[model samples]
Target chain A: MAAVDWGTTRLRVWLVDEAGNVLAERRGDDGLITAQAAGFSTILEGHLAAMGAPEAMPVIVCGMAGSRQGWLEAPYVTVPAPIGAILAGAARVPGQRRDIRIVPGLAQRQADAPDVMRGEETQLAGAGLPAKGRHLVCMPGTHSKWVLVEDSAVTGFGTWPTGELFSVLAAHSILRHSLGEQPQPVASGNPFFQRWCEQALAEGGDVTSRLFSIRAAGLLQDLKPGDAAACLSGLLIGGEIASASRRYGKGGSVVLVASGALSTLYTEALGLAGLAVRAVDADEAVRAGLIEAARKNGMIAGSGVAA
Target chain B: MAAVDWGTTRLRVWLVDEAGNVLAERRGDDGLITAQAAGFSTILEGHLAAMGAPEAMPVIVCGMAGSRQGWLEAPYVTVPAPIGAILAGAARVPGQRRDIRIVPGLAQRQADAPDVMRGEETQLAGAGLPAKGRHLVCMPGTHSKWVLVEDSAVTGFGTWPTGELFSVLAAHSILRHSLGEQPQPVASGNPFFQRWCEQALAEGGDVTSRLFSIRAAGLLQDLKPGDAAACLSGLLIGGEIASASRRYGKGGSVVLVASGALSTLYTEALGLAGLAVRAVDADEAVRAGLIEAARKNGMIAGSGVAA
Candidate 1:
């Protein structure tokens, strides 16, 4: 069986043996936008062939490929939906020789604050959250999600534009003058990052009002570009955590599904916001989720094994 | 005498009589960035020349022309300082035949929340708030300032990147896909604007969390580009107003120092947030400020007449 995560701008594939051990792996920039133009089946079959996948092997996919604009529209499973509903709602691609299914996303259908997530749903499914208890899962990315789960079912969630806001402000806003041509990487240890993160949390997530201070500090106090960048990053991430904590109520520990830089930043920020964090690698979670979907959909044998 | 409002990206010059009545006017895009390379004196003289000003005629300038990177570095007057201090601290351009002076901006030097305003301080000087009582002035722009003025003195202020944030998010973020290439004009009457404004105020200004809803609404509900843009605008402005009202408190009426579209939007948002608005034209305020500075510096006689 093969598992694929096809997002808006990235694609990853992993081949698994019947025992759920990885046999081969492939990654590419041929995401929804590119694959839509070049053709999804063409791209998927190429990767499968390059990995020497069997002609009749089944494939499970998640992410933007399941969106309305992607290869197949896997209709959203609205919360408070059971995790099993996601596997059951998988949309099978028509006219494909191999059995290929795309996992459906989750949607919050409230009129005032509607939201939908594609790829992250699969990650949530694979996070191995306690099925019998309430849980809060934090998946930080371009659109970070703070999800509420209870008894293996998603109850509610909110998305924060933390990463996207940081990117646009750093590149297009007047703060760019203070941040310089290329912003420096923000580390968890940077004092400015820690300070602004604490400040934003203290202020109850009122961050827009403090944004201009970065530009002013650069002008009045000669704040370095790197420090300014770190400050911006901290404020955005801190604001996200502060708002999320307020909305979700900081529980004992949040399940943080992230990897690399975002994971480090969120870990530091959530700690500053007074929450313990349980770590989960996003890549592994999604692969596990796809594998689980494959087994549930009868594409793979129901072996009592965890990937 | 010539009164010039030279900012980072714009230049406005008005030739005024001793009575402070504008005799001729010239506007150009030769702002700080352009003038820095073309020579500030050269651009000033060209505008002055077009307006038919005498070579020896004195000029009173405000805004970025007085910044460290401008024609001359007019050192900031730290607040709580009187409006007169801005006029008193004007920096004269050296080695120029014309007796040109640039009014100094006001700065709040608190280490925890340092803030500075270059162009808006000049507008504050001319906003004409009651000199005997405390007042909150909202100056909407690329960087919106909610200034606390008392007895003709500026005590403190907070700058919110409301306008800039709107621009960046609309142009560079995933929201751009929701908001079309050229987003339709967002009027104050747009229900999305009114709803989001009230919502942000109700949510205590935690707007970063709601930012993704604009994107999601587009994906799930097929929100039109214009409405999405309006929602973004409302959230940013409402968040700014909410956070500002929290810090400054909702007083009787906010002195709204703005004009055009911003004037309309802020007026609407502020009203929704439970504050009556007293509107002022930003152009008139800046000109009045420059004229006031000119008279204080003796470039123009202290005429009893007001412009």
Candidate 2:
């Protein structure tokens, strides 16, 4: 059996043996957007062939591939929904050469704060649903998702476009003048970064007003370009934490599902916000989620073989 | 005498007689940024000459022309400072054919909420300081300044980059997909705009999270492109108002210093927030500011002659 996590800009695939041990893996630039134009079936076949996947090997897919504009729309399953229901309600691609199932996303249809998520649902499932108590899960990315899980069910969630907003502002807005032409990486240990996060958490609200201070600090206080970049990151991430904590009480243990630099930065920020974090590598979690889907559908054996 | 309002992207010059009568007026695209390359003196001279002003005619200039990067740095006059200090601390262009003076901007040097504003201080002076009372002045623009004037002195102010944020998100971010190619104008009367403003004011914080809803509403609710644009405007402006009101306190006579479309939109949003607005034309206010500067310096007589 094979598992795939297809998003807007990238694609990752894992080939597993009958016992669910990873035999091979592949990654490509053919995400849902590119795949839609290049032919989703063709792209999938090319990737599978590159990984030497068998013709009859069933594939379990997740993410934007199930969006309305993707290969086929996998309608959203509304919350407070059980995580396992995503696999149960998976949409099977029709008229395919090989068996392929796409996991459904979760939607919050509350009229005042309507929201939807695609790929993050799988991450949540892979993180393991908390069966006994309420848990706060933070998934940071282009669109960061702060989700609430209670007794294996996702009660509600909020999406923050922190990464996307930071990118756009850093590249195109006047804030770019403060942050130099080259993209600057925000490290957790940077004091400027830590200070900004602390300030944001302390300030509590007036985020838009605080955003202008990044530029002002640069102009008036001679803030370094690298520090400006870090400050921007800290302010955005800090605002996300503050807002999410306010909306969803910040008492529970936080499960941070992230990878690479983002994981480190978020871990540090959550610590500053006075919350203990349980870190989970996003890559492994997504693969685990895909394997879970395949196992539930009897495509892959539940027991795993030694690598 | 002549009055000039030279900002980043546009330049407006008014030729006035000694009695402060507008004899002729000219507008050009030679703003501070462009004028830096085109020669500020040449641009100012051409506009003055186009209106057939004498080379000896004294000119009172305001806005970005006084910044450190401009033709001559006027330096910032720090606040809890009187608006009249802007005129007294004006920077004069040396070695020029005409006597050109640029009004200095006001800077709030508070460690936590440091901010600076150029061009708007002249408008405040022109608007006439509120006598023996606290006035909340909302100056809406690319960098909107919500100034607190207590008994004719600027106690403090907050700058919200609402307009710039809106432009960048609508043009460069994923939110652009929901908003059409051509930039849509957000009318004051748009119900979609009104609802978003009300919602933003009601849900006072967590602005970054609310921004994501614009995209979600479009995806799930099939929000129209025009309404999406309006909602974006409402969300930003509403967020600015909410944050500013929180920082400055909502009580007081709210003076909205704006003109044309922005004036209408802000006035409507303020009204929805249950604050009665005193609308002041931004154009007239700036002109009044420049005129006040000229009159205070004895360049133009205090009394004005009707055109």
**Candidate number of the best lDDT:** 1
Q: What are the candidates' individual DockQ scores?
A: 0.79, 0.70
How close to the true structure is residue B77 of candidate 1, measured as C-alpha lDDT? Answer: 86
The C-alpha stretches of model 1 lying farther than 4 A from their native spots are A303-307, B303-307
Question: Estimated TM-score per prediction?
Answer: 0.96, 0.96
Best DockQ goes to which candidate? 1
Residue B166 Cα positional deviation in candidate 1, in Å, after optimal superposition = 0.8
Error of 2 at B152 (Å): 1.9
Per-residue lDDT of candidate 2, residues B173-224 (tens digit): 9889989897678866998888888878875644787888988888778888
In candidate 1, list every pair of residues with a backbone clash.
Answer: none
The lDDT values for all models are 0.87, 0.85
Q: Residues A1-307, candidate 1, lDDT per residue (tens digit)? A: 9999999999999998777688899999999999989999999999999999999989999999998889999999888888877776788899999999999999998888899888898898889898799899999988899899999889999998788788788888888899999997797688999999999998777898789899889877889999999999989888988888888885478999999988898899889888888999998899888888887777888842212
